[model samples]
Each structure stands twice: as structure tokens, then as C-alpha cells.
Target: MGERANKRSFTQSGRGGRGQGGGAHRGRGGAKGASPARTSALEAVRILRERDAFAQDVMEKTVDVARLSPEDRAFATRLVLGVVSTRGVLDEVLNRCMRTPHDVTPDVRDALQISAYEILFLDKSPHAAVDQGVELVRGIAPRAGGVANAVLRKVAASKASFPFGNPAADAAAYARLHGFPAWLAARLVSDLGAQDAHELIKASNEPAPLYAAVCAAKATPEVEDEVVADLEAACAAPEPVEVDGARVAGCYRLAGGRALLDGRVKRHIANGCLLVSDAASQAVASLVLPADRPASFLEVGAGRGTKTILIQSNAQRRYGAQVDGYVTIDNHGFKTSLLADRASDYGVHLEEALTGDAARLGEAVGDRAFDVVFIDAPCSGLGTLRRHPEIRWRLRPDVVTDHARLGLSLLESAAAHVAPGGMLAYATCTVLPEENAHVVASFLKGAHGEGFELVPVRGQAAFATRVTSGGTDGHFCAIMRRKAL
Candidate 1:
């Protein structure tokens, strides 16, 4: 913890390297207002600290919904996510710069973090970064401006050395260097050796790639080929996007930049022919056997209905008819409504969008068991850190066990609603064994799961295998077959 940053300087014109407090540097060309990206980032950080809010929602409202120009939006997003992702490392660096790191006020801490991020990573002008930090601090809490100025100047002058010794030597320190907690690093290393764990940790900081699922509503002998043709024909991508692979056949990873914004892609999404879905998730949607030619399907914890649409859409492609008694349930009405809307948008119809507790699925469906029941259980979400970086800082060890308990109970509840010879699929977007395979193990060991045989997941990449696979984020799913009559 005593590791110090080596003093380094930066020149203004050069974005990344050395001009610390040099006389030639002038102020920013803009007026007195703080940069919008910095402002939005500050607000987002405050919400994260004080409100304990998720970064995605906070960013959506603070930056994305504001609908700023692309550059501004990108900068704001980078700033907010960078700070949230590297809070521990930033604090560690700030402490090296400050005389009294522990006693630094929240306003000062926030200001220094913003300044440090720019100076260390973004390579903004040290003079400009310092001036802005002082100005922002003065605006918020005038008394802290002096401390903010001095600490950030030192930070700007120092090489941003994230101190972790050799990864193989000290896994805990290696974890700290890469902006993850010691426990998490140790856990990852314990599960997947040092090298793979390091790669996974580093990968989490990068932006997750976008993927599109071409929904099969109206189709033929070669639906996969036809779906790809239609998307390529639409031709609205800013850059040409090549097809990623056919592991799931129906899902295609976005090979180009921001295809979601392209006019053609948006049109396809609007037409219900394509939905932004991950391949690994699509694989889980495919692995479970919905009653052979399933007439009825039940989906519990139907968040935004991505899996619901996939399950039914895939079923339709195979069987030529949609599930007649499709019912999707989630405790939140907003999510249930969203499920309905998204399903409709994807041209996948839902017979029922019921709002109810997933643990009480028996009551919600009421003696009407479906041929296939899918439970995409709530989890600690360790697997999805790429899309949701805030989870790394906010998540804890205890939450895994807690989620496992809830997930298993929900799985148990789902058992009651599976008709004879029916199939039940359980899945989570998390890498931890405690919440995934271990949860299934516990369920199978129990009396409620006595009549079911665990069905191996096919065509999906799991965390244990590796994150190098182009399609997934540590997804886990198992298809189960209930004993037949």
C-alpha cells in the first residue's frame, strides 16, 4: 500500500506525455463551464457513491438520455466507467499524491479522481486537468480547491504505476494492480489458474462486443442463411459487419462498430426480425428441450424477455408453430410489460405476461404446468462484468451464496410447474460455481429434484472453459429432463 508514483511531467499539446505546471500552457478554449463529459461523470460518480446506484442506469440518464453528440457521449461514458472501474486504483494513486489520503473530503476525492483519470489514462493536459479540477472543486466546495490543486498536480507529475508485483508471485497484489479486489483475484486464480484469471480480469475492463440474434418468425429450409442475407441486404451498418459464427447459428456477433445505431439494423430490430442478443445466452435458449414439439412453454424470471423470444422463436423454426400457452413471469410489472413489448417487437407472441414472484411460480401458473419451463435465475452476475463494470466494485463474496439460495429455491418452485416428461432449463449469467453448477448440484441432491436428470449444456461457452471464446460472458445453463409418466 506504501507504493508511490514516480514523478513524471507532461506537455500540453501532447495528449499523454509531460508538461507539469509549465509556463507556456494556457487555459481551455471553452468558456467557464466545466466539460460536459466531466460534469456528467461527476454526477454519475456521486450517484454511485451516495445512492448506491448501478452504473448503467445512472449513465443512461446522466449521459445517454441527455443525447449529447457522439464524441461528448463517448468521453462522458469513458470518464464515468473509468472512474467506477478503477476506483480502488485511483484512490491508491491519490493517496500517494496527498499528504493525508484518509482525511480527504468526498468532494476533493471526487475532483482528484476525475483529474487523475484524465491525467493518467485519458492524457489530457496536466495544466488544463489541474485548472479544471481546481475550478470544479471550487464550484462544489470552495474550501477544498487548494488540496485538489496540489494533489492533482503531484498526480499529473507522476507516472501512473498501478502497483502489483509479479502476478504469479502475489495474486492478491496482481488483482489490485488490475483494478479488482484481492479476494476476487484470488478466487479467479484459484478457479482458472493465474494466467487465464489475469486475462479475464483485464478483459472485464474492455467494452463487451455487441451481438444480434436474427429471430426466425417467417422462415424456410435454410433459415439461418436467409436471416443473414436479410440483415446484410439491409446494409445500414457504419462499417461492414461479418458474421461471427454458427455455434448457435441463429445468433451473430457484431463484427463492426456500433451497428445498433445503423439505420438498417434499427429497422430490422423494429421489424422484429432481429434483436440484440448474446450468442452464449442464445445457446442456453437452445440447449433446453422444450417438450418435444412443445405446445405450452413457461418462462420464469423473464427479464426483458430476450430468452422468452429466443426460446419461442427457435421452437417455431424447428416445429413450425409457436407455443400456444406461452406464459412469462417476473415480479416487477415494468419488466413484465417490457417482456411483452420486446417479445412483440421481435414478432414472438406471449400468451401471458404475468407479474409474480419467481419463487412462487406455482401460484402464478396455478396448476397449469407447461411442457417446458425455463428459469433464468437471478445471480451475482460475475459473468457479466464487461457490460456492467460497476458490479466489480459493488459486488461482495456473500452475495454469491445468497443468490445461489434464491436461485435454487426458484428452481424448486419451477419443478412444480413442469408437466410429465417435460424439460426444465436453469441458467445464470454468472461465472461462480456456487451460483451455477454447485446450485444445480445442491438441487439434485435434494428431494424436490429427485425425478430429474441434468442435461448437459451444448453450443455455449462457459466461464470455466475460458473467456477467449468470442461469444459469451461466463454463461451457465443446464437442461433437465423430468422422469416420464
Candidate 2:
């Protein structure tokens, strides 16, 4: 995916599967042969390998075009995500099952990996997995069915000793067990220590929770009640999200599996009463807003305006008025257009939505200054792995430091636009120190940062989150104040 597509998918919210429910369709090799869900998943895996496509995008398109039943659709989604996320370990284990792993073609390997994922990770019947796996291989490479059947049977038996090494003693073993690149596993160990790194790795593979933010601009007492009632009517089972023992006022966690597709939920989204965003993301928006409302505001890297609406909503709740001069900038014109549309939907007034590189703020906004400047800088997105499992495989090791360098450059440019005594907020959705703390440290020692001083956020010295299974995605935010002239 391109940068725009990546950001769009990363920020948007929806239900991702957790491998719930099981069954199989039995038949020979042909168009109508094996299970429809499995076949669809196989095709998606092929597309991901050949094109390096994002898993969610490929699966969304595949499921929509296939017209499968709700159960089959869910099954297909789980299979595709599971296979893609666990591919590294699946290959290692499958190789042990074959006498000559090098002889396996990509087409046949894709089939074997799908079945291996089912047998090892999912709680499906081994017999069914093997039978359907053989047929799937036959559908593509008819001569490989025997090889598939033999290898898959071996894979099933070898699951008890999978990972094949002691993870507690070896980082590479842990990486293999979790389908992560060895270098990434080692780096996480170096950065977060072994225990937290293991927790993050395991959590990154699990299903992400569904969250929704109530539109602050329209959240009057009556409107809030109506929206809550609508959520209940749709069986979303909305519950308030709490952080550090305090409830995030307008944020909620949804429990309904079909909530995203419900008519009432869809209507609310269309009318700007609700939006899909993570609790951590909402918290960051809340933390960045000044205690005393400012007359002017600027948001850098504003992709699709989710945070724009969020920051404005928090301001509305706190001051009961919108900032008089609100502006936004993003590298892509299409994203700027999207932000403008979403801002209008949420009843937010933007003074301007400019399209330009934020690394050069002078050229983009012509030396204009704002009371508050927020940079939601782009990074490796390690913290949101649960939502976008494909990233673990696609991200390169050198890219983390490269992103940190770019983040500092953006901060340098953004600092010039912060009015005297105004706030400068920096944020990213990544767990690595290189992109978070290191970037902050480097910026603080730079020329522009000499005029500013670090400040507490939300009563803490600094704010950064850890990825938790069934909890919020990892995020980091820092606040600084420019000295008064």
C-alpha cells in the first residue's frame, strides 16, 4: 500500500476476526471444489506474496467480491489474517515436514501454509485441515497433492514440539514461534526487555478491540442520550473506556460483532454522531488540547481528519466553543480533501486545509503562527500490529531510525509556527524508542527546540502506552511550551 492508503487503513476502525467458529466443505479439485472460505483465503495469500499488498485491503476486496455467507466471510477473514501473520513460523515448521523444502513451488507453498496455520494455530479438526489442504494444493498444482498430504500430516503431528526450541533462552526461537523476523524480535528484546517484548509480540497477533468516539461538536446531553440509545438498539453494548482509573468521557468500547454493519451504527457514522477510533488515540487528542482554549490551532500530518474532529470535540466539551482559527496540512491533496469532507461532517470549521509537505512549513503556510501545533508524524506503526498484521513482515529494520530522523525534521519545521508561550505536541503510533523517546531527545537539543521547554501531559512527566491484549494500541505523546517573548 502507498503512504496514503497505509495511513487511511491504519487510522480507520472496523471489526477484525479472532478465528471464531469452524467447519469444512468437502469436494474434489475445481472451481466448486474445496471450501469457498479456504479458497478465497488462498487467493488472498497469493496476492499478498506476489504484490506485497496490505492484508486488510486484499481481504476486504476478496470477501466483498466473493459474496459468501456471514459465517464463511468471517472464516475467510480469520484464515487470511492468520495465515499472513503466522507465515514465518509456518514455513519453518512446514520445512521440517518435507524432505526437500526447496522443491516446493510458491503456489503449493501457499496452500501448505494455509493448512499449517489452521492445524497449528486455529482449533480446527486436523483431519479436515489435511483433507482440504490436499485438495487446495491439487486445485493449483495437481501433481502436488500427494506431497501436500504427506507434509500436512507431518505438520499436524509436529505441533506439540513446535517452535522447536526454548523461547526463554533464545530470541530467535521466540521469533520463530511467533512468526516474527529474528532481527525485530532481538531489537524488541533490546528495547523493552524480554518479558514486555514477549507480551507485545503475542498481543500484536491477537484481534484488535473495536472502539468508537462520540462526535464532541454534536454531543449535547440530549444528543448523547440518543446516540447511546441507538448504540444499544443496534446491540453494540457500548461501555465507557477508562485509562488510569478515569473514564474517557465520550469514548466507548463496542462488543457487538456486527455493529460496524448495523443500520443504526452506519447512520450515526454518516451523520457525524459516531466515529471509529482507538481509546489511546482519543486519549492523545484529549491530552494535547490546552487547559485554556486557544484562538488558533494547527494540525500537521492530518490524515482523513479523525484527530481533527477529535481535538475539536475535546475543545468543545471543555470550553463550549470551537477554536476560531483551525487549519490542517497533509502531504497528499486527496487526504486534505478527505479531511475537509470529514471536518464538515463533524461540524468543524477549518480556516484552511492545505496540501504540502510538513517538513517545510514556511513554504506551505507562509510563516503563519498558531497558538497550538500538533504533529501526528508518520512512523513504522509497530504499536498497531494487532490492527495491521502485515506490517510486521513488510517493515524494514533501517526504516525505524529513518522515521526518527524525519520526525525530528518535521518537529523543527513545526516549532517555527508555535506562538510564544503556546503548546507544541508530538505524537506517534509506535512502541520503538527510536521513533518515540529518541526523536524527542534529538529534537530537544536542536536549534528550534532551544526556545521550548518540556512539560507534563495528563499529570504525567511524559505519556506513552504499551500494547495490551484486549486493551489499547501502543502510543506515545509529549508536550512542550515555547518561551514567552
Candidate 3:
């Protein structure tokens, strides 16, 4: 056996596995087959470093190249996401374990981080993971093999604890340990208060459960539950159980949505009339269901028409025969084609699925035409952190802060299309004040000069208080009436 013992097990987790201190140990020859499996993870990390690809993207691409078995692909993807999520914590550990911390290159650091994640968080044998990491380096960057082997071995042998001690006492420590940027941590702390911020961060780190909204035409909550249970049992990753039936679609939330589940879900999704939707997203669309009778409605920034479907469902039920027209707009023509497909299913006659920038919607649709215009503006998408974890790494502080200007310009464009007594609902999935309240406030200040006045409508108290109280996404909707201009 190697001097460094195997203390973890990648095959099984939770109990009776490695890290019990007395679990069964694999012999020296046991690691031979495992090195190639670990190389999948190394390839993922290398792509992440070289191309700035997301861990999941890299994992998917590498799996195709390596032709990993389904089981190995799942395991490798897990390790990649785990390492990326804990990069800061692992770096702290590597610094303590290395002879000289600053000497480690980014590529080497990524490899070391992969090893550390398996050793610390995953139930993998530290010795095997470390050794495999060294082999991975030799395969990728042959020149660094000796140094990689030595550094990884030193890290695996360390009994020293993490350097940024006591996450409870230090918010930065918690952020670093959990793989979030410092500014994001501070912003969450300020927005959600300390205790809630901590809890939210914890939730954001884990993989989000896949959910489906059951279309009422196909399945009920009872039927959806059985489908979810069957899917969960079929795969290790669980799908969401039917907790509550949706008002529009008979969709059930599932626990998992790994790419493998797509083929499985497709049958149920088509037959059951269910569509994949995040719970948060479904909530946002439900905020305003316009009165059904012969009303002209506009959905601005209708990216892929997810919310448009929600709106149409509401219209289909409430109006039945009263819907005069549905107009959806987006800057991209590709998304408009998608919208047209979805519109066909619901018998919605899309008056105009215009392809123009949101900041110029006023020119596309003449003055004061729409009864309701939903401005689902482009945003940082911070509120959806759980599903889009890569955004944390991709977003810059200025990107969010400067978004208010873009949002304001778009709002200005859309305001002209709101009829005399129409509603303008401005919403974003981000939690930033600049993107939410501040943008709304600035837009209202100028729009007021043109006979627009913010109306204190019922059901808007939650947004008025910045609480998102009605199970809504982080949103801002200001209903304004133009005074016979």
C-alpha cells in the first residue's frame, strides 16, 4: 500500500463508506482502473481553465470526447461541480499544504482543487484521488508531472485544518468556503440580513431540483406524483414530487433533471402536457392575469416565451373567447420562432412577435396600444442562483450596477405603448436595488412628465415593500395610468 492511505470511497456515500476510519481499504492495485475515471474530471478542469467554460459545459463536452460510461459520466460531472463550488476553500487548503503557495499555476491549482474536493467533501480515497490527479497532469501537461505528484501528495497527507476558520464568526470565511464572490456575499448579507443570507447561500450552492408545471389538460397532482416517484426510483437523482397542482398546467415538480432524465421525462412531459419550469419562474408569471375579454396584451423582452405561455394559459382560462390579440416581442428572431411554436399549441394568434431591441419597442408598436405590457427586462439573473450557479463566476459587479441604465431605457420605450389606463409591469429575476426599485423610481420620475402616474394597485403591496410576499420572483411591477394624453 502507498504511504498515504485511501480514506474515501467514491462509489458510496453517507454511511459504511470511506472516512469511517475503519472502513475496508483497497490494495495498491485497486487504483489502476480508477486513474482513467479521474482523468475525466481532470479534462473537465483543464477545459474550464483554458476556455473559461462552465464546469457543467466542460463536463458534458469532455464526456463526449472520453466516451465515459454513463455511471462514470455522472460521477465525473459531480466531481467537477463540487470542485468548482469549493474552489476557494480548496485553494486555502492547498496554500497551507504547498511548499510555496504563490508558485502554483492556475492549471495546477485547478487540478489540486479537484483533488482537495474529493478528499475533503466527497467520500473518495484521498490517496487514489491524489495519485490519479498526478497522472492526469502527466497526460495533459507532461512537463508538470513531477511537481504535480509532489504537491498533490503533500496535500493529501496534510492533517491541518482549513485556514479561514470558523465560518460562523466570519461571513467572508463562509463565502470562501462555499465558493461565492465576496461582493455577492456582502450584497446578500445586506439584502437578506445575516441569518437568511447564510441559509440562502447554502441553498444556492446545491444543485437545484428539476420541476415541471403540469398542464391542466393532461395530468392532475395525483397522477403527477406517481410519475415523479417512478422517475426518481429509475435514477439515483430524485425528481420533484407533486406538492401542489398549478393553476394553469398540471405540472409536478421533480427532484432531478440531469440530461439523462430528458428522454425519460419527454414521454410524461408530452402525454401529461407538462413543461419544465422553475417554481420561482412560475410564480413571477402568475403575478398579473389580465381580464380576459377582448384585451390587447404585450409581453416585452419575451425571451423564449416562458412567461408568455404562462400569460396565455391565464388568458385561456379567464377570457376563453375574449382575448383580442397577444403580442410578444424579443430582440432575437430565434426566440420569436420558439414563441410562435408555443403560441400555436394554445390557439393564440400572435399579432406581432416583433424582433427589435426592447429599448426601441415604442417604434415597433405605435403609441398607447397595449392594455398590459410586461417588461421582463434583461437582468443579471441573480435570484436564480440555484439553477445557474455559473453566473456567480461570470457576473462582474459593474455588470449589475450598470444594468439600471439599460433597464431605464427599455422602460422608457415601453411606457409609450401603455394605453391610457393600461398597466406596465417591470420585472427582473435579480435582487439588486439598481435593477429593481431604483430603475423603476428613475423611470417613473421622467415618465411622470408625460402624463404617466404610478397607481397603487392591490396585490402590489408585496413589491412595494420589497418583500416578494406573494411567492413571486424578485420583481417590480408599477401599474401606471396615462391621464388622457
Candidate 4:
């Protein structure tokens, strides 16, 4: 979860050259007649699989450079996200049709994935899907057209039996139905009972909601109303959001989904009048801010400063001023620079943005103690599967354990910086117990946590938000206070 900034620059309208270098087309296949949106979708998926890049980043760059209309841009986005999110299911269906699935080249497989997604999930015509899919495969491998046609027709025939199993009785079947890896599905079921696991799996496949937070540092009393009015005018339908039973002053849910493409909204983002962040993330930032403002604040893993602005915004709304001394530490130098830049853009001041590992905080800032310390520890990002669909396929079981180990180390180091009688807060974007509750329990039992006492967040000892369809992403936060000397 390093530098997990919510930079939602999704819509871009332009006409440019098509993607190149995937071997010259052998003959006239569907590649000649396929929509630019479909071609770009295929290329984006290929890049994601081959290079192991984030789906959003690759899709954004792919669509921006390709020549496509606004409608095509939207369609391309849907195709790329859909294909990437459901890769496991699509491959399973495709493999069922062929005797030797491994014989299919990567590019051809990608084309089939795009078409198969439309056929099974979207309301696409099966005949057209098969035709275009065959042509797409031919474009990549001239001799594979016959095999592509045969395989896709079988895939189209199997559309009714897409999942091909009874999900209610089998974990593997449930994983196949929801496009999740078997290991992740079983793990979720084991960690969070079957019912909650089903709910989470279903929600992860749906589209994530869009949320925007008003930049409190930029919106003064005199101009706050104008900014809100401007945002409403530009957006299709914007609704205010509430967290922990209180209305978040400047937070909104952009229900329309096209607000980011609006010129006014883009201007707002560019000028730092608005920022894109999940509601749960904003809540975690608020939970980190104590009721009584602290004289000094130190933030660990302050990625790209989204949470930094959020914490300071809460401070401004609650205490009417920013903290006097603000410091940040990140393992990456580039991220530290980005944090500094974002803080400046939002008019928040940082006394120091140090580049060092949080696990070695003692070496980074010797003998410096803060009134409040926050560790937004890095984790497997399992809770953000809806927004980062690729993680479900890319993540492994051991990775979650590794992150738990790293999280505990960061917590132990960060706890040492908490002043007597001050507070320390820890958070992660994962819902796994090993990374969230287990880490905290381990910390409280460790020597470094001897003087700290658990403090309930919003009346919960370990506050956890589950992912919901068309709602906030999942998050977890816990707070502790050090005893007075």
C-alpha cells in the first residue's frame, strides 16, 4: 500500500496512434474491423499481464494515447477493467474448450478474454462477440483463426453455465463464480464467516464508488460555499457523506461517476480545491486526530499525502487550526517528495518530510518524541480489492503473512515515538485479521507497548469497515494511549 494515492484521472478524450510492437498482423482478421476501444482494451490487458503493472495505470496511459471517442473511451475502460477483474473465470471457461490451453499465445488469449467478458457478463451479442473475437485472434496469430473460432463458439455455448458449479456448497465454485482465486476465497471464508465472505466477494466485483473531499486548506469560510456550489453545478448528482454517525463537512459521493471528466471538477482538482479519496480512508484520518489537538504530530507511511491533508483537514474543522509541528516519514524518497508537494498544494505545512524506513524510526529522528504518532502501516491491500482488482489475482497467501510481520515492526518502532500521556494510532487498508487485529494484539504484548492502553475508535476496540457495493472501501484503525509517568 505504499503511495496509494487516489488520483482519479480516468477520463481522457483524444485521438492518437494505436499501440505497436506486438508483432505485425499476418492477414486481415478482426483486428482490421475491431473497434479502437476493443483494440486498446486488449493491449491494456496484455500490458497488465506481461509487465505486472497496475491495471488502472496501464489502462489510463493506454486510453489516453489511443484515438478514441468519449463513448469509446468509456467502453474501453469498462472492457479493460472487466477483463482484468475476471481473468480467472474467463481463463477457466476458455480452457474448458481447448485440449491444450497452454498452446494459445498470450496476445490471442488476451483478445479472447475481452470478448468472453462481454459475452458472459455484459449484454453483448454472442454472434458478434464470436466473430470479432476470432478476427482478433487471427490478427495476432494468422494460423490460429480456426482454433479461435472453435474455442469462442464453445465459450459462447457455455455462457449459461459460466460459473459451472454450485457456489453455495464449494469454496472453489464460489471463487470461480466471483472471479477470485481459490486461496483468497477460502481464506476470506475462513477469516470472516461464509456469509460475510460472500458479501465481500460479490461487492469486490462491482464498480467502486467515486468520492471527493473538499480541500479544507484551500477553502476558507469566505470561499467554501462558492466551491461547494461550483462542484454541485459541475457534477451530475453529488451527495454528502457521513461517517461514524456524523456528517463529514466537505466530503461527497459522486454518484454520477462522470464528474471527474467535467472540466470544472478537473480544474478543482488541479487547483487543490478538491481531492479524490475513499470515505473510509477519510474516516481513518479523522480517527487518528485526537479530540484535543496535539502540539506535535508524526506520521509514518504518509503516502503521497492524501491522508496527511485529510488529518489536517479534520484538525482544521475540529480545532480551528493545524498542528504546530508536523513531521512525516516514508521509506521511498520519491513518495516523500510527493507528500511535500501535495501538502503545499493544499496549503498544509510540514516541518520535515524525511525519507527513511518507519521500521528504523529511531535512527531517522533521534530522541524526538511527538504528542501524537500515526502509523499507516503497509499491508497486502486486501480490503481495496474493488478498486485494485488485480491484487486478487496477483496476491499470494504468504504475502499477507509477510505484510503482517512488516506491520508489527512498524508499529513497534512508531510506538517508541509516542510521548507519555500522548496517543498513538495505527491503520491499514486490509481487512485480514493477521494484518489488522493480530498485529495490534502482538504490539500490545511486546515490550515497546508496555505503557500503552487500548482506546476504542468510535466505540470499537478495533474499528473495521467492510467493503460495500456502491459505498466506501474497507479500512481498519486502532488507537492507544501511553500512560503518564
- Judging by TM-score against the true structure, name the best candidate: 4
> Compared with the true structure, what per-residue lDDT tens digits does model 3 show for residues 257-332?
4532456556665563456665545545555554444378888888777677656654554545424567888888
What TM value does model 1 have? Answer: 0.83
Clashing pairs in 2: none
Q: Rank the candidates by lDDT, best first.
A: 2, 4, 1, 3
List CA RMSD, all candidates.
Answer: 7.1, 4.2, 8.0, 4.0
Q: lDDT, candidate 2, residue 309?
A: 89
How many residue-pair clashes does candidate 2 contain? 0
The CA lDDT of each predicted structure is 0.68, 0.81, 0.60, 0.79
Q: Which regions of candidate 3 deviate over 4 angstroms?
A: 1-37, 50-71, 88-109, 154-159, 216-249, 258-264, 268-272, 321-324, 338-349, 448-460, 463-485
Total residue pair clashes for candidate 4: 1
Q: Model 2 residue 27 lDDT?
A: 35
Clashes of each: 7, 0, 18, 1
- Model 1, position 147, has a per-residue lDDT of 78
Candidate 2 per-residue C-alpha lDDT over 162-271 given as tens digits, one digit per residue, 9 for 90 to 100: 77779888777778878898988899989998778888999887777778888878767688788888889888899999965667879988874477677877888898
Model 3 / residue 230 / CA error / Å:
8.4
Q: Put down candidate 1 lDDT per residue, 210-240, tens digits, no spaces.
A: 6666778643346546556655665522122
Ranking, TM-score, top scorer first: 4, 2, 1, 3
| Angstrom error at residue 292, model 3 | 3.2
